[model samples]
Target: MKILFATSEAHPLIKTGGLADVSGSLPSALAHYKHKVRLVLPAYRAVMERLPEKSLKQVAKLSVGGCGREFEAVIWQLKAGAVPGVDVPVWLVDIPALFDRPGNPYLAEDGADWWDNGERFGVFSKVVAELAMDRAGLQWQPDVVHVNDWQTGLVSALLSVETQRPKTVFTVHNMAYPGNFPHSLFAQLQLPESLWNLDGVEFWGHFSMLKAGLICSDWVTTVSPTYAKEICYPEYAYGFEGVLQKRAAEGRLIGILNGIDEHIWNPEVDELIHSRYSAEKGRVAGKQRNKAFLIEELALLNGLSETRIQGHLADWLQAPLIGFVGRLVEQKGIDLVLEVLPELIEQTPANFVFVGSGHKSFENALRDLAQRYPERMWVYIGYSETLAHQVEAGADMFLMPSRFEPCGLNQMYSLAYGTPPIVHHTGGLADTVVNATDENMLAGTATGFVFYDPSRFALKSTLLHALGLFAKKRSWQKLQKTGMQQAFGWKASAQRYLALYVED
Candidate 1:
C-alpha cells in the first residue's frame, strides 16, 4: 500500500516534539515491509536549511492559497534514509510567504502563536488533500492518507468531499490544542460554507479543524491506548470528548503506543554520553561514569554550606540519580516539581538534574532552587540534543511527572538506555512505564515508579519509595533490566499501522 504520512514537523529536518520522531521513523519502518510510504511536511525555513541542496528535487508546483490569490507551491522531494535499509520519500511543500519564517514553525520570536496559523496550515492541508486525490500535478496517489495532530487534521475533512478519495486516518497527538479559529475564517480558509454546522467542523462558536478529522475520517487514532481512553473523558478531551465518544461508539477511535529510534537512542552506539554500554555488558559501571560526568558538569558536588547538603554526601553519591528532561511547563508537571522540591530535598538526598526550559516563572523558580541546594539539585535551562542523550544514558531514574502526555519518547529512550523512569499515571507515561512495586517486582513485571495523583505529596511519596528501592542494588538492577528488555521500536508499531491501513 502507498501511504501519504502528512505532518507539520519531521525529525532531522524539523522537530518540536515526539510527532517529528514518529513522522520521520514510521515511514521507513513501513517501507521495510514493502509498503511505499511518502512523508510530507511544509518547507519551513529550518527544514530547507537542514537538508542538503542535492537531496531535494523539485517535483511539482501545486497551486494553493486563499482569498482568490493563488500561491505556487514548489513541491520538492528528498529521501529520509536515517531509519536504515529503507529510504522513505519526503515531500516538501514550499510556499515562501507561509513557511519561510525564522523561529519555530508554530510560534513567533516573542513566543506567541502566529496570527495567520489557521490560514497558513489551511493552505498546506488543502494541498495535501489534493495530493491524496491524485490532483497535485503528480502521477501518484496514496492508498491511505495518514495525518498527525491538529496541524494536519483538516486533510481528512478536505478529502471527505471527493467521490473517490483515499482512506483517511487522523492521529491526535494531543487533544488539548484544538485547531480552533474564529468563525470569521470560514471564507478565508476557502472551506465550503456548508461545513460550518456543529455536526461537521464547528465547535462551540469556532471552526475546529481538528474535529473535522474526527467526524469525517474513516479511522481516528491517538498516540497511546491509555490516551485514547483518556480523551473520552471531559477533562483530557479539552471540549472534544463528545466527538471522540461518538467516534468510539462507532468503533473508529483507536490507540497505538509510540516507539523510539533505538539506533539513535541506544547507549552502546550513542557517542554523546561519557560512557557506553549494552544491556548485557557493563550497564551498571557505564551508567555510573556518565552520571559522574553529569554531576560534575552540573556542579552537583559544590555549595556544601547548607547542612542538608553535607548530611547525606554518601547517599547523594550512591543515591538514585533522578533526571527530568522536557519543557518546564504545567502540562509536564514542572509546577508540581517546583512545589515539592523543598520537601523532596528534605525527605531524600537523591541527586537531581533537569534539562529543558519553558515558562519564565518555572525557569526562574528552578534556577533559584538549584542555586540554594547545589549538591542535591542541578538544572540546565534550554534543550540540548546531546545533553538529552547523555542524561538518558546516565540517569538511574528519569522523571516525567506529566499531567497528560499523548506519547513521550524520553521514557522509552530511558528504558532502552537501562534507565528506569518515574512517571505520573497518565497518558503514554502510564502506558509505557510499569510501576515497580513490591508485588510487581516479585511478579517480575515492574519497570519503573508510578504515582497516580498529580499532587506535590503524591510525587514526593513516589520519589521516596523509588529511593528506598534504589538503595537495594539488586532490586534496582532488576527494574532496570526489565525496562531495558521491553521493545518499543517502530517495527512493531508500524506493523499495527499496516493492519489498520489495509483493513476493510
Candidate 2:
C-alpha cells in the first residue's frame, strides 16, 4: 500500500509531543512491513539544520493559499533511512518565512502560541490535501492519506470535495488541543462561507479543524481503545462528544494503541544510558549503577544508597528512586503532584528526579521543592533526549499520574526499561499497566501501580503503596520483569493500520 503520512511534527527532526513520535515511528513500522510510505511535513528551520544540505533536493515550487495571502512553497525531498531495507521519501514543504525563525513550531520564544499558527498549519494541510489529489506535480498518489492531530486535521477537510480522492484516516492524538479559531477566521482564511454551518467546520461559533476532520474523513481513530470510548463522554470530549457518538454509530470511529520505536528506546543497546542491561541478565546491577550515577549527576547526596533509613536495604541500596518525565502542566497532574510533594518527601522514603519544563508556576514550585530537599529531590527544567533515555533506564520507579492520557509513550518506555510506572487509571495508562492489586499479582499478570481519582490524596496513597512493595525485593523484581516482558512495539499497531488502509 502507498501511504501519505501527513502531520506538522515528526521525531528526529521536530517534536513538541508524542504526536511527533507516532508520525516518525509509525511510517517506519509500515515500511518495515513492506508498505511504501511518503512522510510529508513542513520544513521548519530546526529540520533544515538537522538535515545535510546535500540531502535536501528541491522537488517542486507551488503557490499555497492561506490567511487571505499566497505563500510560495518550495517542496524539498529526502530519502530517509528510517527502517531497514526501506528508504522512505520525505516531502518537506518549505516556506522559510513562516517556518524559519522559531523557538517552537507553534510558539514564540516567550512561550505564547504564535499568532499566525492558524495560517501556518493551514497552508501545510492545503499542500498535503493537494498532494493526495495528485495536483501538486507529484505523480505518485496515496492509496490512503493518514492525517494526525488538529494541525493537519484540515487536510481531511480540504480533501472532502474530491470525488476521485484516496480514502483518509484522521487520527486524534489528543482531543484536548483542538484547532479552534474565531468565526472571523473563515473570511481571513479564505475558506468557503458554506463551511460555517453546524455539520461543517463551524462548532458553535468557532472554526474547529478537528471537528472538520472527524466529519469529513472516511474513518476516525484515537490513540487507544479506552480513549476512543472516553471521548464519547461530555467530560472528556471537550464539546465534541455528540459528533464522536454519531461517528461511532456509523462505525467510522476506531482506536489503535500507539507504539514506541524499540530501536531507539531499547535499554539493552541504547548508548544514552550509563549502563546497558536486558531483562534476562544484569538488570539488577544495571539499575543500581544507574541510580548511583543519577544521584551523583543531580548533585544530590550520594548517601541515599548507604543511609539505611529502613531495615529493608539488606546492605544494598537504601531508598528507591522515583522519576517524573513529561511536561510540567496541569493536564499532566502537576497540580496534584504539587499538593503531594511534602507528603512524598516527609512521609515516604523515596528520592525523586524530575526532567521536563512547562508552566512557570509548576517550574517554580518544583525548583523550590528541589532546593528544600537538595539531597532527596532534583529538578532539571529543560528536557534532554539523552537524559530522558537515561531516566527511563535508571529510575527504579517512574511516576506518570496524568489526569488523562490518550496514549502516553513514557509508560510504554518505562515498561521496556524495567521501570514500573505508577499512573492514574485513565486512557492508555489503564489499558497498558495491569495494576499491582492482590488479584492481579496472584494471577501473575500484575505489571505496575495504578491509582483512581485525579486527586493529590489518591496519588499520594498509590505512591505509598508502591514504596511499601519496594521493600520486598523478590516481588518488586517480579513486577519489573513482568513489565519488561510486556511488549508495546509497532508491529501490532502497524498491522492494524494496514488493515484499515486496505479495507473497503
Candidate 3:
C-alpha cells in the first residue's frame, strides 16, 4: 500500500501537540510493515532549518492557487533518513511567503492565532490534493490519503470533486479546534462551490475545515474508541454532532487508540533519563536512584536515597514522588490538582513535581504553591524533553486527571516507564488504564488507578486510594510490572489502519 500521510505537524520537525507525535510514529510503523509511506507537511522555518537545502532534492515546481492568489511552490524530498525510526520518504511543500516565519506555526508572537491561518493551511491542503491526484508531476500516487486534524482537513474536501482519486481517511485528533473561519473567506480561498452547502464544509454560517473532512472523506476516525463514540453527542462534538452522528449511523466512524514510539520511550534504551531499568531487572533500585536524582535536580528535600548505593536503602526513601507533565489548563483538570494539592501536601508524605506551561493563571498559581512549600512541591513552567523522560522514569506515580482526552500518549508512556498513572476514567484513559480494583488486582490484570466523575473530590480520593496501594511494596511492584508488560506500540494500531484502507 502506498499511503500519503498528510499532517500540519510531525515530531522532530515541528510540534505543537500530540498530533505531531501520531504523525511521526504511525507512518514509520506502517513503513516497517512493508508499506510505502510518503510523509507530507508544510515547510515551516523550523522545518527548513533542520533539513539543509543541499540535502533536499527538488521534486517538482508548480503553481498553487489559494487565498485568492496564485503562488509558486516547490516540492522537495529527502534522499534518505527522512524520519529517525524508519526511512520513509518526506515530501515538504515549500512556499516561503506563507510558512517562512518563526514561532508557533499557527500563531503570531502575541499568542493570538495568525490572521492568515485559514489561508496558510488552505494553500497547503491544495498542494496535498494535487499530489494525491497525481497532478504534481511526481508520477507517484497514493492508494490511501490519510489526513489528520483540521489543519489538513481541506485535503479531503478538495479531493471530493475528483472521480478517480485515492480513498481518503480523515482523523480527528481533537474536536475542540475546528479550524473555522468567516463564511466570506470561503469564497476568497476559492474552494469548490459544491462545498458551500451544510452537508459539506459550511457550518452555522462559517466555513468549517473540520466539517469538510468529516463529510467528504470516505472514513472518519478519532484517537480512541470511546472518543469516537463521544463525538456523536453534543458534549464532545463541539457543534458537529449532527454530522458525526450521521457518519456513525452509516458505520463510517471508528476509534483507533494511538501508540507511543517505543524506540524513544522505552526506559531500558532511553538516553534522557538518569538511569535505565526494565521490568525484569533492577527496576526497584533503578527507580530509587532516578527518584533521588530528580529530588536533587528539582531542589525538593525529601525522598532522596541517602546511601546513593546500587541496592535499595531504608524505607524512608520509598516515600511517594508524584509527577505531572502536560499543559496546565482547566481541561487537563489542573485546577483539580491545584484544589487538592494544598491539603494533600499538608496531610501526606508525597512530594509533587510539575513540568509544563499553559494558562497564565494556572502558571502563577502553581508558582505560588511551589514557593509556599518549596520542599514538597516544585514547578517548572516550561517543557523540557529530558525532564519529561525523567519524570516518567523517576516518579512513583503519574497524575493525568484530564476532564476529557481524545487519546493520551503520556499515560501510555508512563505505563511503559513503570510509573503507574492515576487518570480520570474518560476517553482513552478509560480504554487504556485498568483500574486497580480488588478483582483486577487478584487477577493480576490491573495496570493503574482510575477515577470516575469530573471533580476534585474524585481525583483526591483516587490519589489517596493509589497511595494506599503504593504503600504495599509487593502489590505496587506487581502493578508496575503489569503496566510495563502491556503492549501499546504503533504496530498493532497501524495494522488496524491498514485493515481500514483495504476494506471494500
Which runs of model 3 end up more than 4 angstroms from their true locations? 300-316
Ranking by lDDT: 3, 2, 1
Q: For candidate 1, give the lDDT.
A: 0.85
Q: Which RMSD does model 2 reach against the true structure? A: 3.0
Q: What is candidate 1's CA lDDT for residue 364?
A: 92
lDDT by residue (tens digit), candidate 3, 416-454: 999999999889999999999999999999999999998
Cα misplacement distance, residue 276 of candidate 1 (Å): 1.2
Ranking 2 against 3 by TM-score, winner: 3
How would you encode candidate 2's per-residue C-alpha lDDT over 1-504 as one tens digit per residue?
889999888887788889988988998899998887999999988888878688778888788887777899988888776323224789999988788886878999988999988888888888898888888787888999999988898888778877889999999999998899887776787776666689889888888888988888999999999999999999899999999999999999998999999888988988889999989989999988887666666643323343332333332247888999999998899899889888878987788889999989999999898888866787888988878988898789999999999989999999999999999999999899999998988887899999999988889889998999999999999999999999899999999999988887
Better of 1 and 3 by lDDT: 3
lDDT of 1 at 312: 52
Residue 407's lDDT within candidate 2 is 87
Question: Clashes per prediction?
Answer: 0, 0, 0
Candidate 1: where are CA atoms >4 Å away? 82-86, 300-316
- The alpha-carbon lDDT assigned to residue 84 of candidate 3 equals 59
